[model samples]
Target chain A: MTAPAGQRGRGRPRDPRTDQAILAAALELFTEHGHAGTSIEQIARRAGVGKLTVYRRWGSKDELIAAAVESARGEIPSPGIGDLDGMSYAQISQVIAEALPGSARTLAEPGYRAMLAQVFGSSVTHPGLMAAFWNDHILPRRRTAHLALSRAVDEGVLPPETDIEALIDMTVGAVVYRLLRPEPPDADELLAYLRSVYEQAGMIPRR
Target chain B: MTAPAGQRGRGRPRDPRTDQAILAAALELFTEHGHAGTSIEQIARRAGVGKLTVYRRWGSKDELIAAAVESARGEIPSPGIGDLDGMSYAQISQVIAEALPGSARTLAEPGYRAMLAQVFGSSVTHPGLMAAFWNDHILPRRRTAHLALSRAVDEGVLPPETDIEALIDMTVGAVVYRLLRPEPPDADELLAYLRSVYEQAGMIPRR
Candidate 1:
């Protein structure tokens, strides 16, 4: 096997800065115009990179779309699983309020919402891409949250028999639904609702 | 002003059966192919009627889409507000299971799911159509459920302070989230989850 092109001292060296530009461009175009509306040429032009550069880096439009989505996912902050062990209820709520609403704000953007709609809409026709998205992006994040929740249960912060997976699903799912609606709930309103839900669940005592 | 064609009836009379055929065809095509993919011509052809018939009845594709979605909405059974008073926990649980899972099953269909995604995805670009959909379809259904839930609160089946709107939003949103996923939860599983959530919320007591 040949050394990867970036490692070889042949031709021009691959610039990390150019990769960031391309990824950002890809994400913007994909979100704004959707999969069918976006083109690799448009992404290249937006990034001020050669068409060959994008192709060489991503292989195909599908791969580029996946990369852009993955990049977006990375930008969102998630709670540290390690922090769950010693965290108090207020601290956990703070983590959720910060992490979830920030992501909701991102999701509420017209372009980003369009991108998600495109992916979900096309999943029936493109099962492989959907599977990759689930395995690589959705599942890992879910597992992280799940593990943290399980720890909360073990520590008696949540009841022993609480269905952590369903709890996570319901909480996240409600936020997503609000984001997808024509009129999303205000961030403060959503935070308050979540606080009430957690309090009612006995995850935290009512204030 | 000239009398409408249906009433003028110079040559042929308007048949009610033909109206049903057009409505059914519109719903099918709109669900399967989405708003942009479907056309009046295609709908007419599918219904074995002339294109003029569709235009005469619905005026435009947007109106036709609204009519089709409205028709589908009418077909889904909702709990009457009258039924909520004095309903027992087990009775309420049964009502929720039947009403929710049935709607979920319909929403889970690839065709129906595509229709919803198309409407939601295009909301940014086509606010008029989206507004009409929300006004004519979403709002009415929500109102029905809201009235029923308000009765539940009044009857002491649910807490006096229950946030009926938020409760409705979270419950429906969770189901919508599950239905929209590539691998939706099983029907029975979702029903059980809903039951548990209701029980935990004190809308119903544990079995």
Candidate 2:
């Protein structure tokens, strides 16, 4: 289905930079105006590209918005479990201390917060999008963390019968609840709170 | 600045029934269309009242919407701490089993879920609304739960140094995360998970 050589030469090939520009514009506008309020035309104009180009690249506004959200999330660091085997309580405490603050910082980003709100709100009406997000973004991260926690449990770092799924829920849920607050706690305060959680769970020895 | 007796009689006192009708209509509309999508006229028409009456009563759509949300929440039974004093592991387990399910049920309602989505999404743009909700609804509930947890700690039902606030966050956040999922666990499964959490924390002894 390649175009004739002459036709291909007359029209310049699609520029890779256009994709980045469109995604950037889409993210900004989506955060500012929300999904319903934003239009493809505005995204194109903001990106300094033609509407047809946007349509050609992404068939619908929903597709473009999804890509923008994915782009905004970027890369989530996969926490490794190699050093977790037979880790001492102090070592486990250090791991929690280092991990939680990074999570808090990422969730505290204004754009990410806005995007999450939109995703959750829209999920009710659009279960498909929610499914996709869970499959693509949430499930992978949970799997990685689950593996690490399982290793920790196997090595007796956590209690033998530890409910890893619920533990993950509590840890992740607490961070999310803080982000949803009108004035989320500062990173230092959040880190202190995480420390308190670790201490209560007996992951860190009392002073 | 009382109105003259004659003027008051001519105007006829505002009907209390109208208030009920408006609230009912508002809750239905807000749940179906969300805050941004719903309008005063639709609510007035649905309630069989004049637009002027709706405006005069509520002053603004946001006020009306807030009232609707409040009414929908009905009453949340404050989990009492009196019986918690000297409570056994089995008794504490029973209390959690009763409490968490009720909270989960309220959160699982379609109307309530819609309202939560709207609140979370709009909170980014409307911090004032978020603050008011926090002050009026969230703060009171948290305070009640906080009091109960503090009492539990004092009674030795929970560890002496338990981070009561973080515990609350973890409990509430887990239920919320479950609700947000595409296919949340059933009541029995959720209760089992919650029991596991309590057991792992040594709040309840293992069977």
The DockQ leader among the candidates is: 2
Worst 10 residues of 1 chain A by lDDT: A1-10
- What tens digits encode model 1's per-residue C-alpha lDDT throughout B78-186? 6764676566545655665567667656665566666665565555544455676677656755665565566567667666766666665655555555655666556
Clashing pairs in 2: none
Q: Per-residue alpha-carbon lDDT of model 2 for B59-148, expressed as tens digits?
A: 677888878767765544444556565655456556655676675566656666666666666667765555665665566556555655
Whole-model lDDT, model 2: 0.67
TM-score of each: 0.75, 0.79
TM-score: model 1, chain A = 0.73
For candidate 2, the docking band is: acceptable
lDDT of 2 by residue, A93-159 (tens): 5665566667666666777777776666666665555565666667755664565566667667667
Prediction 1: B-chain TM-score: 0.72
Give the TM-score, chain B only, in order for the candidates.
0.72, 0.73
Candidate 1 per-residue C-alpha lDDT over A1-207 given as tens digits, one digit per residue, 9 for 90 to 100 = 132334333355678898899989988876665566678899999999987788667667787777777776665566665766566555665565556566555655566666665565445544444555566557755755665566667667666766666666665555555655666545566566655554443334456
List TM-score (chain A only) for every prediction. Answer: 0.73, 0.74
Question: Which 10 successive residues of model 2 chain B have the least lDDT summed?
Answer: B1-10
